[model samples]
Target: MTSFQFTKMHGLGNNYIYVNQMKEQLPEEELSEIAIRVSSVYTGIGSDGMILICPHCCTCEDAHFQQ
Candidate 1:
């Protein structure tokens, strides 16, 4: 089994699972599947959704560009 670290955060009753993409890499194709599993109350971590914490640098090709 694959193992990674995550953090759970909530605000005004809404909650989400956070994964640090800068520290760990996840398969891009499986992102949707992973989200569904982790968001399941009976089979997984149970959250409204998953959030990926990406690095903010030009070197990171997948990183979002900010002005």
Candidate 2:
């Protein structure tokens, strides 16, 4: 079986699933279905939404300048 590493978090009382994109590649076509399936209250993992964790490509200097 295939496995994907993820994290789970919640805001207020609403729960969500977080996927680290640096490690998992979810195809564009599967995005909508992935969200729907994961968020389904009755059929799937049951979340209010899914959150993606991705790296920030810019340098620290750029971040400081943007601030």
For residues 19-51, write the lDDT of model 2, one tens digit per residue: 888756777577677777777887667987777
CA shift of 8, model 2, Å? 1.7
Could you tell me the lDDT of residue 53 within candidate 1?
A: 86
Give candidate 1's root-mean-square deviation (CA, Å).
Answer: 4.7
My TM-score estimates for the predictions, one after another, are: 0.76, 0.67
Against the true structure, whose lDDT is highest?
A: 1
Write model 1 residue lDDT over 1-67, tens digit each, in one string: 2467899999999999989989678887877788888889987979998888876767645744221
Candidate 2 vs. true structure, TM-score:
0.67
Backbone clash total for model 2 is 0
